[model samples]
Target: MLRTSLTFILLTIIFSSQKPKKNGVKDLFKESFYIGVAVNGQQVSGKEAGALPLIEEHFNSLSPENGLKWSLVHPKPEVYSFDFGDAYVALGEKMDAFTIGHCLVWHQQVPNWVFENESGEPLDKDKLLARMEDHIQTVAGRYKGKIDGWDVVNEVFNEDGTFRESKWYQIAGKDFIKNAFRKAYEVDPAAELYYNDYNVWKASKRAGILKLAKEMKAEGIRVDAIGMQGHYTLGGPSLDEIEKGIIEIAEAGFKVVITELDVDVLPRPNNSEGADLNINFANSPEYNPFVNGISPEAEAKLAQRYADLFQLFQKHKDKITRVTLWGLHDGKSWLNNFPVRGRTNYPLLFDRDLKLKEDVFAKLKVVSKQ
Candidate 1:
C-alpha cells in the first residue's frame, strides 16, 4: 500500500512539473505571429474598463476600431479631432503592443465635403489629389514613428476585380490609390504600408489585388503587406480557397496579414457574404434565432470553425505576420448590427461577459500545438 501511494505521488509530481499549459492566445502563438485585437475609444480611454485587462493579456498588437477613421478623426475639412486617436496610441505604448493605423483612404465613412468644392460640386483631379495628400500627411504624419504599420488604402476593388467607382476613383482614378500610398510613405517611411480588403478569397478579387500590388511594386511604391479581411461565416468560403489566397499572396513576395477576422454563426437574410458595410437586412426572428444565446450545437460548430482556421494559420505562420480579431468580445462585435440589425451575434473569441469561450479557446490552444 505504501509503494502504491509513493508511485501515485511520483506521477502527480511529474505531471505538475512538465510545464503549465499556455492559456493566453498571444503566448500560445508567440512564435507564430502577433495576436491582435481592435479597440474602440471607450476601451482605450478606460471607459470600457473590463476590456483593458483582456487586451493586455491576450493581444500583442492593437488597431483602433473607429477612432482613426477619416470621418471620425477629420470630420470636416477645417477640423481635426485627435483625442481618441491620442488615447489609442498611448494605450498601445503602455501595452508595448504593435500599433496599426487603420487606413488613409476608404470610400465609406468619408465626409462628402472631402470630395466636393465650395460650391458643393465635385473637385477635379488635381484638387482632389491635393486633398488626399493633405489628409494622408496630416493623419499619418501625426502618428509617425508611433504606428508600426498603416492600411494605406482599403476595399478599393470589387469582387470582379474592377476598381470600385467610389468618389476617389471617379474623381482621380487609380492615381488616388498610388498617391495615397506615396503620401503615407513620405510621412512615415518607417511604417509598413498595406492594402486592406475583404472577400479576397474570391479568385477574381484576389487576382485584381495581386495585379495592383505588383503594379505598385513595379512603379517603385512601397507596399509592405496585404491585409486579407477574414470576416468569415461558418458556412462558406471553403478552407481551400482561403489557403490558396494566403499562399498566392505570400508567393507574390508580400507579407499576408489576416485582418479583422470574425466568424459569424448567425443565419443570413439573403445569403450575403463579405464585410461590406452597405449590406443591411431587416431583422427578423428567422435571422436571429439565438436571441437568448447560441445553441449548444451552434457553439460547438463555432469552436470547430475557429479551431480549423487557427490550424490553417499555424500551418502558414511563416507567411503571415499578424492575425487581428475585429473586436475584443461578442458584446462589442460590429456583426451584432451589421448585415442584420438588432440581432445578437456571437462572432468573437470572447463571450458577452468578457470571458474567453473556453471551448473555442481550448480548441485554438490545441491548434497551436499542432
Candidate 2:
C-alpha cells in the first residue's frame, strides 16, 4: 500500500501543474471543460438548497441528470414541477454557469404508469412516439434557450455494446433514439441534443454508437454531442484505454462530456484488507479506488492519476467541451447508497466537511494549471 502511494505522489510531482509553467491546464479550462456538477435538489445539512456554493466556486455549468427527468419535472401527471429545475437554473444563472438539461427519455427515472397501456402494458408504436414527443417538447420547451445541452437519450447501450431493451425500443422500435433527438430539436432546434451513456470508451462500443450517429445524420436528424458517463470502478479500464476513447469520440464529430464521474472504493478491494469501513469515499471521492486508504504516498499517485486524465482533457480540449463532476461534494453524493447497498462510496471533488480532498484540490489545481 505504501509503495503504491509513493509511486503515485512521485508522478504527481512530475506531472502536476504545480510546476511553474505558463499556459498550463488551468488556462485550458478557461475556454473549454467549463467544469460542472451533477447535482440533486434534496435538502442538505440545514441548507435545503444543496451544492450551490460549490457550483459557484468551481463550476461554470450545472446538469441535473436525475432532477430534470420526467418524474422529477412532473411528479403528478400534467402538473409540471418547476420548483427543483427553477432552483438549479436560478443558481446557474446567478453564478453565470451553463445549465444542461440532462435527459428527455430514460428508462429508469420515469414512472411506469404513464408509459403503459390501459391493460398495464406499454402503448403502441404510434402512441409511444407521440407521448415521447409531448414530454420532450414540454420540458425542453419550458427551458428552451436557457439549457446548454440535453442528453436526449441516456445509457442506451448495454455494457457489452448491445442496445438496451427499453420501452422506447420496444414500441417506437429502433427509431426511438433518433426520435428523441428529433423531438428535442423540434422544441428548440437551437438547444444541443446528445446521446449520453457509460462505458462508451471501449473500442467496439464506441464504434457501434458512432455508426448509429452516422445513420441518424444520414436520415436528417442531428445528434449534437455525446456524453460519456464516467462512472468508473476500481480496475474498470486503463488510463491509456480511456484517453484513446475520448480522442476517437471527438474525432467522430460529436461533443463529449464526462457527465457522471465517480471512482468507487468498495468491498475493501481485498488487497490491503483494511477495515470494512476505514476508507471513506465520503471523505475523498477520488481516492485511488484500487488502493485501500489515503496516505502521503497514495495522495501523490492519486494526484497523478487525476493529472494524467486532465492532461488528456487538455490534449482534446478542442473536441471535449465539458467535464462535469458527478457531485460537488461527498455529503450529498448518491454514491453513498448506490450499487453497494449500505456502503459509503467517495468518488468526487470534495469531502463531507466541504474542504477539498488532497486528490480533488490537487486535480483542480492541475485543471486550473495554477
Candidate 3:
C-alpha cells in the first residue's frame, strides 16, 4: 500500500513539473506547434489580467499582426509608435514565446489618401506600384530581425477561391506580390516569408497559389511558407484534405501552418433581425443545432474538432511549422462585431467563463502525451 501511494505521488510531481511541452524552442521546428492569440486594449489592462491566465497554459507565440498594421504603428507618415507592438513583443519575450509581424503590405488597412493624388484622384499604375514598394520597404525594414516572419499579404483570395482585384494588382500587375517578397527579403533576408490566405485548402485557390509560386520561383523569388488561414466553421476541411494539403505544400518547397485558426459556434435558422450579427461566419445552410451559444453538447463538438485537427497535426508535424489561434478568448474576439453584430459566438479553444473547456484541455493533454 505504501509503495502504491509513493508511486502515485512521484508520478504527479513529474507531470506537474513538465505540464507544458518539455522542449520550448529546441523541438519547435520539429514536430511542434506555436499556439497564440490576438490582443486588444482590453487585454492590456490590469482589470483583465486574471482573465488571460490561460494564455500561459496553451500558447507559445504572439501575433499582433493586426495591432501593428499601417493604422496603428504609423498612423501618419514619418512618425512611428512601437508602444503597443513593443508591449506585445515584450510579453512574448518574457514568456519565451515566438514573435511574428503580421504584414508589410495589405490592400484594406492603408489610409484612403495613400491611393490618391494631390487632387484626390487615384494614382495610376506607375505611381501606385511605387507606393506599394515604399510601404513594403518601410514596414519590413523596421521590424527586420525582430520579427520571425511576415504575412507578406493577407486574404488575397475570395470566398469562391479567386483573387480579388486590388490596387497592387492593378498597378504592378502580377509582379506586386513578387516585388513585395523581393523587397521584404532585401530588408530582412533572414525572416521567413509567407503567402497567407483564407480557404487555401480549396481546389481553385490552392491551384492559383501553385501557379503563383511557380511564377515567383521562375523569377527567383522564394516563398518560405504557406499560411492556411484556418478560420473555419463547424465542419472545416476533411481530415484527408488536410493531410494531402500539408504534404503537397511541403512538396512544393514551402512550410505549412494553420494560421488564423478559430472554430466559430454561431446558432442557425437565421434570426432575420440578427441577420448581419456575425463574424466571418457564413449565414447560408445554417447548422442543424443552431449553435447560438456553446452548450455542453456544443462544447463536445468544439473539443472534438480541435482534437481531430491536432491529431492530424501530429501526423504532419514534419511539415507544419506552427498552429495559431485567432484570439485569446471569446470575449475579446472580433467575432463579436465582425460578419454578425450583437451575437455571442464561442470560437476559441477556451470558454467565455474563463474555465478550461474539457475538449480543448483534453486536446492539449493529448499533445503532451506525445
Candidate 4:
C-alpha cells in the first residue's frame, strides 16, 4: 500500500508541473507594473477581431499606434476625426485597461497650416501659441476624464542634448514645451502628462530631459513621467546604459515609463539609432534578408534580449510604472518599413499570425519570477 501511494503522488506532481499557467503576461506582472500593447485602428474597429482577445488576455493598458496622433486625429486645422480614437478608448474601457493618449505635440505628422497662416506665412509667437492652446484644449478636453495619461510632447530634444529646431521651438521657443504641459494640465489636470522621446538612453539626452523635468517641477507644471522610447536594436544600447537611464530618471522624482518598447532584430545602416521618422535608407536586398522569417538562432537571440529587458524592468519595478510594447504583433510593427523600407523585421513579442512567440513569452515569464 505504501509503495502504490508513493507512485501515485509522484505522478500527480509531474502532471501538476506540466500544466499551463492560467495567468497571461499582464497577470504575471500585475503586482510589479502594467503590461501594455499598442492597438492599431483595425483592432479598435473590430476589423482585426483576433487581436481583441489576445490584447485583453495579456495586456492591462492600451495605447493607440496612430489614432491619436496630430496628423490623423486632427489632420487639417478645420478637421478633427475621432472614429479610431473613440473606438480605442472604448476598447480600453471594455477591458478595464489603462488608456493612454499618444501625443498632443510633435514635430512630424503635423499639418503645415498649424505653423503657417492662410497665405502660408509663419504664425508669430503669440498666434502660434494660441493655435497650440486651441489644439490642446479641443482634443484633450474631448477625452479629459477618459484617458489615464497623455504623451503630451514627443521627441522635442535631439540626441546631443539640444532642443530640436521644430516650428514649435522656432516660433514659440521652449515655452511651447512648458505651455504644452501647462495647457494639457489645465484641460485635464487628472490625466498624467509625459515627455516622450527616442534615444533617451544616451547620457546627454537623458540629462537634458531630466533638467527639463526639474525646471517644470520648479515652475509648478504637472509633468508626471518621462517616457523612454525603447526602439532598441539587438546589438546596441548596452543593458547598463538602459538601466542607468531608468535609475537617474526615478531619482529625479519622475516616474519612469518604458514606452514604445520593441527589439529590432535586423541590421541597420551606420549611425541609425533613434526613431526619427525622417530618417530613411534605400531598400536593398542586404537589408531585407529575412524575407520569409527569422531563423531559429535569431529567434533565440530575440527571446534572450527580451528576457534581459524584462529582468531589468522587474528589478526596477519600484521605480518603473509601465512597460508598453510598440505593436500588437510583428505584422503591425513599424520597424518592418522603417530605416530601410520593405525589410522584414521581427521586433515584437508576437508573430505575424497574432500568436505569441512561445520562446520569448516563456523567457519573460521566467525573468519576471526572478
Candidate 5:
C-alpha cells in the first residue's frame, strides 16, 4: 500500500506541473472580461462554415452586424422582421454567450420614410416622438430577456463633439437621447443600456459623451455603460490614449465596452482618418499597396498592436465589461471594401482560412501572462 501511494503522488505532481494549453481569446480574458465578436447573417445561419466554429470556440458574446439595425429590423411603418435577429439570439443562447443589440437609434442606416408622413412632409415633434417610443418598445420588448444589452443610441455626435444635425436632433431635440433610453428601460429594465459612438479617444468626443452621460444621470436616466467604438489603426491611438480614454469613462462611473474593434492594416486613401465608412474613392495602386497580402512585417506589427491594447484591457478589466471584435475574420471584415473596393485588408485575428494568424495569439498569450 505504501509503494502504490508513493507512485500516485509522484504522478499527480508531474501532471500538475505541466503548462495548460492555450485555447481561445475568451480563455485568455476569462477572468478579465468577456471576449465578443460581431456576426453577420451568413455566420449566424452557418453559411460561413469555418467562422461559427471559431465563434463557438473563442467568443463568449455576440453582436449582430447590421442585423438589428433600425432599417433592417423594423423597415416599414407596420412591419418588423425577427428572422435574422431571432437567429442571432438563438445562436447566442446555444453558445451561452452574452448577446448585445448593436443600436436602437442612429442617423445612419435608417429609412427616409421614418422621417416623412403620407404627404412626404417631415414628422413634427409629437409624431416623431411617438414613432420613436413605439419602435423602441416593440423591438426591445421582443427580445427583452434574451438580449443582455443595447447600444441605445449611436454616433449622435460628430468628431468635434457637436451633436450631428441628424433628423432625430431636428425633430426631437437633444432630449431624443434621454427619451430613447427611457423607452428602452421601460420595456426591458433588466437589459443594460449603453450610449455607443466612435472617435471617443479624441478629447472633444470624449467630453461630449461625458456630457451626455452627466445629463442622463441628472435626469435619472438609465445609462449603464459607455461604448467606445474601437475602430483602430496599426499606428495611431497610442497605448497611453487607450488607457486614458478607458479610465476617463470608468471614472465617470460607467462601465466601458470596447465595441466594434478591428485594426486596419492597409494604407488609407485619405491618410488623415481611420475607417471612415463614408469615404469612397477610386481604387488605385497608391491605396492598395498590399494587393497580394500584408507583408509578414506588417502582420507582426498587427499582432504586437493587439497584444499592447489587450495588455491595457487586462489592466482595466474591472471597468470593462466586454471587448468585441468587429468581425470574425479578414475576409468578412468591412475594411476590405470600405473607402476603396477590391483592396485586401488584414484586420482580424483570424486569416482567410479561419485559422489563427501567424504567432498572433502566441504573442498575445505571452502578454496576457504578464
Candidate 6:
C-alpha cells in the first residue's frame, strides 16, 4: 500500500510540472468569451474529418452556415425540412457547444412564395405578418431549449443606414424586425435573440443598428446581442473602427458578437467590399493575382491583422460574448468565390490542408499572456 501511494504521488508531481499544451483558441479564451466557427452540412454530418477535430478543439460555439435558412429548410408554406438542421443541433448538443441558429428573417435566401400570393402578387401587411410569425414560431419553437441563440433578423439595412426596401419592409415596414424578435422570444424565451448585420462598423450603419437595438429595448423585445459581421480586409476599416463599434454597442446595453470574421488578403475591385457576394466581374488576371498562393509577407500581414483584432477583443472581453470565424478553413471560405470567382483566398486561421497557421495562434497566445 505504501509503495503504491508513493508511486502515484511521484507520477502526479511529474505530470503537474510539465507545461500544458495549448490545444486551440478555446483554450486560450476559455474564461473570456466563446470561440465559434460556422459549420456546413458536411461538417455536421460527420464528414470533413480534417476540419472536425480542429473545430472541436478550437470552438465552443457552432453556427449553421446555411442549414437553418428559410429557402433550404422550408421550401413550401406548409412543409418544413429539418434534416440538416437537426443533425447540426445534435452535433452541438453532443459536443456540449453553444448552438446558434443563423437567421430567422432575411431579405435573401427566402422563397418567392413567402412574399407572393397564389397569383404571384405581393402579399399585404396582414398576410406578411402572419407568414413571418408562423416561420419564427415554428422554427424557434422546434429547437427552443437546444439552440442557445438566434440571429432573428439579418442584413435588412443598406450601407447608408437606410432600411433596405425589401419585400418585408415594403409590406410590414420596420415592424418586420420588431415582430421577428417578438415571435422568436414568445416561442423560446430562453434563447438569445440577435439582430445581425454586416459592415456595421460604418458610422451611418452603426447609428442605424443602435437605433434598432434601442427600439427593441424600448419596445420590450428580447434583443440580447448585436452580431457585427466582421468580414474585414487587411488594411482598411482600421482597428480603431472595430474597437469603437464594439464599445459603442456594449455601452448601449447590449452584448456584442464579432460574427462572421475573416480578413481578406486579396486585392479588391475598385468598389468591392470583402464580403460582397453579389459583385461578380468576369475573371481576370488582375483580380486573381494570388491564384497560386499568398506571399509570405501577405501571410504575415494576415496573421498580424488577426492578432490586432483579438487583442481588442480580449481587452473588451467583458462586453463581448463570442467571436465566430466565418468558416473553419481557407479552402472553404466564401471569400474565394465572392467579388471574383475562383481566386485562391487565404483568409482563415487554418490553411487549405486544415492545419493551424501556427504564427496566428502564436500571436494570440502572446496577446493572452500580456
What TM-score would each prediction reach against the true structure?
0.94, 0.81, 0.82, 0.94, 0.93, 0.93
Tens-digit lDDT track of model 2 for 1-370: 9999999999998788565533322234776577777777763122645455545656677788477888888665567888777777777677677788987888777788667876988688888788778888888898888887888887676556677777767677668788888888888988778888777777777877888887898899999878877766544567778888887777877778777776654433333211122233333333234333345654465556556666777777888888877876666676665543344455566767665675556565656553
lDDT score, candidate 1, position 294: 96
Q: Which is the winner by TM-score between candidate 1 and candidate 6? A: 1
Which of the predicted structures, 4 or 6, would earn the higher lDDT when compared with the native?
4
- Local accuracy of candidate 5 as per-residue lDDT tens digits, 1-370: 9999999999999999999854888998888888999999999999878778899989999999899999999999999998998899999999999999988999988999899999999999889888988999989999999999999998888778889899999988888889999999999999999999887888888888899898899889999999988988899888887788899998999999999899988877546454446777777888788878789899888999898888888889899999999999998999888777878889999988898885779887887787
What is the TM-score ranking, best to worst? 1, 4, 6, 5, 3, 2
TM-score of decoy 2: 0.81
lDDT of 4 by residue, 1-370 (tens): 9999999999999999896856788988999999999989898888886988899989999998888989998889889999988888888889998899998999988989999998999999999999988999999999988999999999999888999999999999899999999999999999999999998899999898889889999999989899999999888789999999999998999999999999998889885997998889888987787888898888999999999999999999999999999998988899998998988899998899988999988988898788
Candidate with maximal lDDT: 1
Residue 176 Cα positional deviation in candidate 1, in Å, after optimal superposition:
0.3
Residue-pair clashes per candidate, as listed? 0, 12, 11, 0, 0, 0
Which 10 residues in a row give candidate 5 its minimum summed lDDT? 269-278
> Which lDDT values do the candidates have, in the order given?
0.93, 0.69, 0.69, 0.91, 0.89, 0.89
After superposition, the stretches of candidate 1 with alpha carbons farther than 4 Å from their true spots are: 1-22
Q: What would the per-residue lDDT of candidate 3 be over residues 64-141, giving only the tens digit for each residue?
A: 736777777667656667777766666766767777778667777767666778898978877776776787777777
Writing each residue's lDDT as its tens digit, candidate 1 over 247-341 gives 99999999999999999999997788998988998899989999999999999999999999999999999999999999999999999998999
Model 6 has how many clashing residue pairs? 0
Error of 1 at 76 (Å): 1.0
Q: What RMSD, rounded to one decimal, does every model reach? A: 5.8, 11.3, 6.4, 5.8, 5.0, 3.5
Better of 1 and 3 by lDDT: 1
